[model samples]
Target: MISLEKDAGLWIVTIDRQDKANSLTPQMLEQLCEIAESAREAQALILTGAGRVFSAGADLEAARAGLATSPLWERLSGAIARLPGLTVAALNGTAAGGALGMVLACDLRLAVPEAKLFYPVMKLGFLPQPSDPVRLTALIGPARAKMILMAGQKIPVEEAQLWGLIDRLAPPDSLLAEARALCADTLGASPAHAAAIKAMIR
Candidate 1:
């Protein structure tokens, strides 16, 4: 399930199927894309999870049924990337498979100390969505991106931080608070101003 909370100019989106490690179904993925597309008026947006694991990627059944290679993953990530708001990935936990696409598109990524980062597309016999590798490489470099994308190695939060995959680490209890704090300035600024700064970096 995807839950979106709007607070004036700030929007927070959470994947809430905790019983399944937030594994995404096709409907859930579509919901996320719709939310991201509609959030252009938000001054800041935070994408996170409801439980310990941010997302285990696609639901097992869905992936096995051809959802793994769906273009919705690309559409969702692209919508987030095109947002005029400052987008933040508040990784409450590990992000695997297609789940990493949105995180890679975010303007900033802050994860809990225990979160692990990996994309097992290589092992799963599927190539990652189009922009994923390029954004990942832009953040952590080509070799490091290869370590995860090609080797399917899991990088703990500490190593992720060192390698630039994670911009900061927040304790579990304080994760959302830290995200809101990080968005404070963006929320206070005009949407145009925030978008301008974000675009300058792009």
Candidate 2:
């Protein structure tokens, strides 16, 4: 369940499975990876969830059925991370579990004031994908990463922003508008320069 819309030089991608908290299935991940691969032609890309929840993470039912794995999550998130242009995660709501990987992969993250973020791998008795921990540590450092991944703590929007996990907070009603504005601000830079700087730092 994914919706892609092109607006000028921007591509907005939304997860459309609100009935399941927008939890991602293998097919959904594949689609997302495909979009990420093709988004290089756009000036920027924005990823968000349709209804309330941004993403509840991997589909547990599918995982239980042996239909999902860390590799699939890695493939999807890695694609997003490798995107040449600016990529933003517009967190309309909370993000949890493997969904955090997607949020972390984005070049910038903008969350609604009500958004919360967490990873419950330890609480769920599951080992987080190796890349997940590495990315988390790179963004917010080892201590904060430990609190989030090892302790299963819920990070509210304010703390997440202070910790550098979220770059800004927008009101729920204006989240997408804010994300677009942020993307517009980055348009002055040539895509080649931006991609080069991003690759060097990341």
Candidate 3:
């Protein structure tokens, strides 16, 4: 489902469903939320997926099987949004649908050069969660958010960076290094001060 590796002050969380491009299941989401709740003491947090994907998005089969409103699902999405730690998404590959939503929730996002970003919730005949659209618009502006969500447009990493969806870009091979640098910078700040600044921003 998900793997957690704590390296000194940093906590690394990886989605490990490589067979399905690391698609998120309700149970996996629950585990993630639980792990994140217990990781408040960490200096920084990094999220990435196994194999080549950051995530393919929500598990559609599970959703159709009535898992969408489960407590695990809610906790997964809501907890990430409220995480007190400095969070970063290391987008190692493509991100779509709920995967894009997850990236938007993070405090910062770094994408590999070949990665792609898009939301297909509309094409799937579903509306994205309110917070997803709100956060996307906040980061990239209403117009850009509308263009992506309404049009189901897949933005390349370079374009996503230009539009402000991604904060940094790196070669696929150096993506981890870039993510590490960003995490190091974030962890340099006092956790208490970081929390205060985040609270003030909200």
Compare the candidates by TM-score and give the number of the best one.
1
TM-score of model 1 (CA atoms)? 0.98
Candidate 1 vs candidate 2: which has greater lDDT? 1
lDDT of 1 at 89: 96
Candidate ranking (lDDT, best to worst): 1, 2, 3
The better candidate by lDDT, 1 or 3, is 1
Per-residue lDDT of model 1, residues 48-156, tens digit only: 9998999999999999998899999999999999998888999999999999999999989999988999999989999999899999999889999999999999999
- Weakest ten-residue segment in model 1 by summed lDDT: 186-195
TM-score of 3: 0.90
Tens digits of per-residue lDDT, candidate 3, 1-202, equal 7988888778988898999988878778767778877777787788887778898877879867755434554455566667776788999899887767667878889988888898876777777766788888888898999888898899998999998889998777877777778778558888887778777877
State the lDDT at 31 in candidate 3: 79
lDDT of 2 by residue, 28-54 (tens): 988888888888888799999998899
Off by over 4 Å in 2: none
Cα lDDT for residue 101, candidate 1: 94
RMSD of each: 0.7, 1.6, 1.9
lDDT at position 109, candidate 3: 94
Candidate ranking under TM-score, highest first, comes to: 1, 2, 3
Give RMSD (Å) of candidate 1 vs. truth: 0.7
- Select the stronger candidate by lDDT from 2 and 3: 2
Best by lDDT: 1
What's the lDDT for candidate 2?
Answer: 0.87
Q: What is the alpha-carbon lDDT for the whole of candidate 1?
A: 0.94
